[model samples]
Target chain A: MGEEKGNVKWQMNQKCATIGFHANPGSKAVKTRVSLFVTCIVDQVFPQVGIAMTQVLERLGYPVDFPAAQTCCGQPAFNSGYPEEAGIVARHFLNTFRDSEYIVVPSGSCASMIVHHYTDIFANEQKTLEQARSIAPRVWEFSRFLIEVAGVEDVGASFDGVVTYHDSCHSLREMHIKEGPRRLLSKVQGLTLREMEPAEECCGFGGTFSVKFPEVSGGMARTKIESILKTEAGTVVSVDSSCLMQIQGAIDRARLPIRTMHLAEVLAGR
Target chain B: MTGQPSETINQTLGDARLQLAIYSATNRLMTHRAGAVRADLLPDYQELRTEANQLKKHTIEHLDHYLELFEKNVIAHGGKVVYCSDSQEVADFVLGLAKERGAHLIVKSKSMTTEEIHFNERLEKHGLEAVETDLGEYILQLAHQRPYHIVAPALHLTRYDVAEIFSKNLGVENEVVIEKQTKIARAALREKFLHADIGVTGANFLVADSGAVVVVENEGNARLTTSAPKIHITVAGIEKLIPRAQDLGVFLTLLGRSATGQPLTVYTSFLSGPRRNGEIDGPDEFYVVLLDNGRTKLLADPEKRQSLYCIRCGACLNHCPVYRKIGGHNYPWVYSGPIGAIITPQFHGVLKDPWLPFASSLCGACAEVCPVKIEIPKLLLKLRSEVTDAQRRQGVGGVERLAFGIWAWVMTHPRIYLMLARIGGIFLPLLPKVGPLGKWASQREVPKLAKTSFHQWWKAREVPK
Candidate 1:
């Protein structure tokens, strides 16, 4: 009973809405402004996805701004168990996006940092810890925010392809933005959405993990591509660009002719 | 990849390539799992995970009460429930029952719990033939190899491999086609299933309230394996027990979806006990052996207890990056993947497979996929600590201890660490082009050092105007 109370107390102190975790405004009224956190990977590798994300948010009447100097979410270090290094990176992130009302990211992995890691990231510094807790409630994945928060199902975009979506690990499992993406995808006109097999599994593209555990990553990618092939879809779509890139890398390696795209890209009607 | 450690088992699975092949297959399955979670599930999926976790926790906490109720119900329904404290006892009880019944042939289904006990070897010692009815198990039986993956047992074997095995073993000369291979195994196992006096199977969940054991499978082999035999013996870990039948809804919902990413398995068979008077096809005698086998010890430790919540869904195994590369044979146990890293140490004792826990990249993907929400990485770390503690007590080997002791000293002293890092930055790269160190750096590129260390850079940055 005491333990349960302690947990509840800790939870209550951490002022965050667990509902629609990847959503932006959610069902609750927002007094503060909101900005989009275009993740490092998207900023670097697929800038178009970032632009699509902004366009989508703009379409939803969201005043989305890219917080410059937001390098990475520090997940690379955090997941690697280098707490000290992760702290350094996290402190950098917090300082960069210190003024945002809500920090929404295109990637689930980055969103999870705000939701899951920030509290632990600022465990020592009391003031920063409060900021982390406050910031966590507003951290949203792009699709999650659109579907759950803005109540926008169709982005008024058109894409014609039998596109299948890959669920990134942190997004689907940690953030639980499963239905939000599909719900939005379901609204897209001229899109013949064929479901792929074994969809909830990881693509084995865990940031540094892909390089470090290359064989496992490759194997996971191969399987993902095989399933995509089974679906007979010309294009494989996923919310996380990292998963798409991983499967795409394998698809290229295997010399298979399947194209991979981000959810933003698909939703943006390309 | 590191070579397999020298141990009791000779030729630590001459199936590394085979395992690689199988892991490739599992990866495909994992991608499907990814798609399933992404496309089909709601954004509130974490809520489901929390609910599933709560359900499992609630079920585990009141397990004794449930077990008692389950046992009573099983007996009420004409099933004999045997709770064995250890694997050997469970084997003994089963062997004794088989002897009493004069059972000479036993057909088996895919059960990791039964595999854990080496029940086939035990039965074989008594001159009883145990035939695996599952297609994958049959393939492994022919190959003389253990299961590499949980969900797909002979997942390592290609259709060509299976065809070759069938041709050699069954005197058929057909080029390996998946259809032909599956048909052959189906035909071959069907004969064994009919003639077998008893059937041994694994339970997906042992419902405490109903005293029922449920088996979920894609292939219809389990159906035949259980009902065809006169006597049916269900072997399962004690942790498979859940509070009630109603709770099975959540588990069944998650199990197939999480495992193979299937909406539902083809067969979800629920067997309460022996056949009733009016029943047409069912076992005459039903035996549920609840094997504790070090799980009680695990259950006692709050930190490690979540290992018990695992439903053997194989989601962790399928998604594990390390398991993909190294495969199951490296673990030195029947169970492999993230669950294996935690449970193998507990069941086989932490002293064995000291390297198993470190096999993980700490990705937390396993915990993500776990239907019951077992925090496998944490348990792996706990087991690693246990292994370290055990090694410290046992007084580790001379060279290993010496190396670690030096490492420990270097780690504690920042001065020594900096000095070594500096020296390493300078001369380590210079001396690495020749000799033993060259061999170490052969396939690997050492990271290029900055002109100044991070500490040095930090100090310079702090020197503000």
Candidate 2:
């Protein structure tokens, strides 16, 4: 299919983007064993993102495994102020990924919760605290893992569309994953990446914040949608699924033509 | 003190005019602040912030010693210092002084502390006229309204609103022009400032070593209020103390830039004491009422005490999205916005409005712009935990606790989590819109679940040799 004006390529690309491909990294040697912690949202809602992420990892010469026992990162409970419940679930997450050398997640929100908040979640419990501390350094968001650990910038994938990136609050502010996705996206051929104004502002899908303060959340989401529309980008992409879901919901509700794609899904394209 | 924050927020959101007013005002302030910081105008901005943070930390850590030293210096400088345990004591002290001196017709400058103490109302109850001299405060006084913004008290009021207020109250022809309204207020307050028995103001910073009450403003009314009256009274929170006069340099540098984007306010008066020997045009008696008023409770907790480091710059409020949406009146106290989110709960206890802490999106914009570098987001999170813990202790939030408990159980058990996801995928579309979920769905569509889970797809694949 040609880079532009091909519905068949888009459909074929979507289907081929499924997981379970073991592709060889032609030029680079295989380096590390990374376990994929497919966040609950990606596992249940956007499975294509996980598939694309795994495909991209395989292309980067990293052996990625799915830890079946892994479940939610307990961020919802933690952020909602139920630390005891959050701690219970965090302990389970820690146990599931205990033996892995590195834990990589496609979602920056869950990844940040694990890396930044686990110590606080497990604080006062000595055993879990130690476990959390040990696991914290090994956790990496998808883009950060690709750039920082796998050391691959250009994933040899190209897309033909204008896209603007949203900085998911947790990843941008907490994990400091600002330029990682942009640097990687810049390498994709035929992709005209237009930077959105006030790109660092929250998309207002702050977990339960959307439901709790729907008016404010909806207003903020509308603001973001307007910003994305102003860029005239066909697709709005981010590393976190939660933010995408919020922004996408607003776009869909408004009946705007913009598509919300995960950075993983976009980067894994051929 | 006000209606439920949720209801008020809803009302504020419903009003398009108020939303635009708040959004534009805050946006302008935030843009100006950003430009001031980015221009590299304040050569040692970051360094000054660090020093200011350290100084506030040191003062708060040793608040008692500084308070004593502050009182001694004020006394040495011929100013009387009265330590008030609460707002009642503050009101009583002011009333007693007024009664002893047979003073009436009080003129005042913009002071949030006086608002906190309800100083004017207390005097008014005794049949004394307490007139506000600062233009914003005077406008609010004439309208019989509370401050809407911390720095710009009447920011929510448009020029048209002010014109209407002056027409109705001041009995002047309705003047739509902004400068005319200012002139009208100046003419009205000029008489009050000249004839008033006492002039009251809030200290921006109380220099402990020098016993100086530093008042920063643009209107020049605070200076006039202190200078024109026979007796000058300064009401300030005990938390407002700094160790030395040199500390003012660091604070003054940040206070203006973060507040109104000014290099320095038009007036920065350092009133050390009452009119000195042979001094012209100053008060005979100067009194500083150091108010505790639940500040000690905040200072008692080391984890939350950093909230006291706030310099009342309102930079956090201008930058906070939640504040931008809800406006200032929704906050339960005089202080609103990000600072209010932390301090309101800390000062008043979280139980009064458990939802205030959760009102924020946990955006760190407040922390980024804080002149004194208070970790506002962290404090907010800390306050959230406190609210939840309070609920737990009181046997409240049972439904929420149970729901979270079940959620935690399902999330930990992958088998159940997957089953629930599948079942939710099937039924979530069918569930009737109701309650919080209904509210969420009203504005935004819920994410549709995938037909197949990622793990299921991964497991079905054949291993490649």
Candidate 3:
């Protein structure tokens, strides 16, 4: 509510500022095709997550396009401060999904990379910067698309388990996605939503940070794993695969019975 | 800071007691802050942050004008203003003043500016006795440690640690009781306040309109530290200026809550100058030392000048996960956590303190809790790029650049990327646990690649287009 005074515009254009996150369901075309930018991690390491996301989107009566040319959102490079490398990769991403009606990303961080970091990457290039901004408003994280864009609370999906939702940082802060995801989870049949104390806390899979500052990152993961254990939830669900990757790694190492699932995979359940 | 961030992090992780102390202290502070700044308690908190941000930004943008106005007002009120380019000059000025006045003993309140310049050590080296009056600072001064946390300088210590330090330094009983330790420090410092010839403090807000150095503190020690001595010296950063006295309402509301979760600190002193004629109490001579120390370089950069907007609230340190893991001694500067991460590199130049910005996970917690609404994560990211650029100039990071370059090439070519993915699905599970992968595998198991990738499955299945 407090805007900048004295015309200097000190806003400085925060990269994570919500560009076009709000959904007006009635004003948008329902038949407009949606493209899935399955993040590199999801595409290679955890493909079932991508499959699950595709199943849910197509079931909702929207044609989902897989832009084969889309390799990555360049988050790994961007977060590691290799922005020039990120720009090279990000420019390709902008081109691949150029004409797509609705670009939906399964991972929160990847979607954030497109909506936020892409503008920064193309800042010096006027033409590409315009393209990046034009495409940013249309990009949506998977769960947000299901709730806000599709206006569907229950996707007629069911999963039997006590699962806590991990609010991945990019989706929570960048996409302003909090209760929207919880609201969707609550509607899932047979799913008992057990909330963890540190649900909003990071699992410490900060791209290269997991390796660069592994001890600190691992320490955070251990703390998060304990929080999940305290909840006594059978399964952990999150919007991003990257967070699950970190949690899953720790859960496996600790030999804990806790299984990590993508929110889409849970929603895609029978 | 005892060592490099990684080195200290490794060392601290092994010390379970120290880790627990840091966690408990920071956790308690976080709980207090959350309750203090809730919407019901402070309804206009967000707007106040914006107003403070705007006010600070305007003042700093026209800092030359405000500095002139502030200096004029201070002089009119019979105070002397000396601008110091660096810590060396600040130390030189204090030493000169002490020698001229024949002041042997000097008492100080909690002043991070003084800590930054190592003022006490500098004075002590020159055979002048400078005693820290704040309980936390006093404990640190005795233990021969630097200020660890912003609000709680001895935050990493426990009652037992305090007992040990007190027993070793002050020859007191090994008192494990909290109140007893406070009394022990209090008893020792009260004598210094009376006998001290000079008192020093750091200003919270330097009001340009009236030239009042506003200090907000919970301890009544600042009142004694500034008033007990005949000479009161205030060492503050040049960026601490605000345009008007009326603007204190906006900052005062946020400062206490953000710093220590108090509605307002116990004492909020607004001192302009020396005592007027017929005044019963106040300093005979007042001096305000405005220290630059690389602040002008930060101010010159339009994108990152908001680092100056920090009010040293310590909210960022309390909420930062990285800070919570590694603790304060890991940060190699007077400031720690998000503020330290950004400022340390900018002040010392990236070449010297290159590791700080990369210390964060870019979690955005610091920015969320900031009283002045400084975009800390963004600044960290910006500094990271600067560090990387500096590294590149030094001909380092060639391998990393080449790896990213190859990654970019492979990523742009869809066929090669997918082809590599198919091959990765087979061999990824067997990847040797070494380097980054080994570091990641230290605590967490490496993930096995999915049997059939989503891309391959999508192409195999012919859905209605």
- Top lDDT model: 3
lDDT of 2 by residue, A1-270 (tens): 333434665444434322211132232433557899998889989999999999999877777889999888998887787878888898999999998877889887899889888988777889888999888878889998777666678999999999999988788777888999999999998999999988988888877777778888888888788789889999999999888999999998999898999999998898
Runs of candidate 1 exceeding 4 Å displacement: A1-270, B1-20, B39-44, B397-424, B431-442, B453-464
Which candidate, 1 or 3, has the higher DockQ?
3
Give all candidates' CA lDDT scores. Answer: 0.72, 0.86, 0.87
- Looking at model 2, residue A262 earns an lDDT score of 94
TM-score of structure candidate 3: 0.95
Name the better of 1 and 2 by DockQ: 2
Model 2, range B54-74, lDDT digits (tens) per residue?
999999999999999999999
lDDT tens digits, residue span B341-367, model 1: 888778778766666665565557788
User: Which run of 10 residues does model 1 chain B get worst, by summed lDDT?
Assistant: B1-10
Off by over 4 Å in 3: A1-29, B1-5, B463-465
Against the native chain B, each candidate's TM-score is 0.89, 0.97, 0.98
Q: Please name the candidate that would achieve the greatest DockQ relative to the true structure.
A: 3
Query: What's the TM for chain B in candidate 2?
Result: 0.97
**Per-candidate DockQ vs. reference:** 0.07, 0.45, 0.51
What's each prediction's TM-score? 0.66, 0.94, 0.95
Give TM-score values for chain A, per-prediction. Answer: 0.86, 0.89, 0.89
Give model 1's share of reference contacts: 0.05
Q: Rank the candidates by lDDT, best first.
A: 3, 2, 1
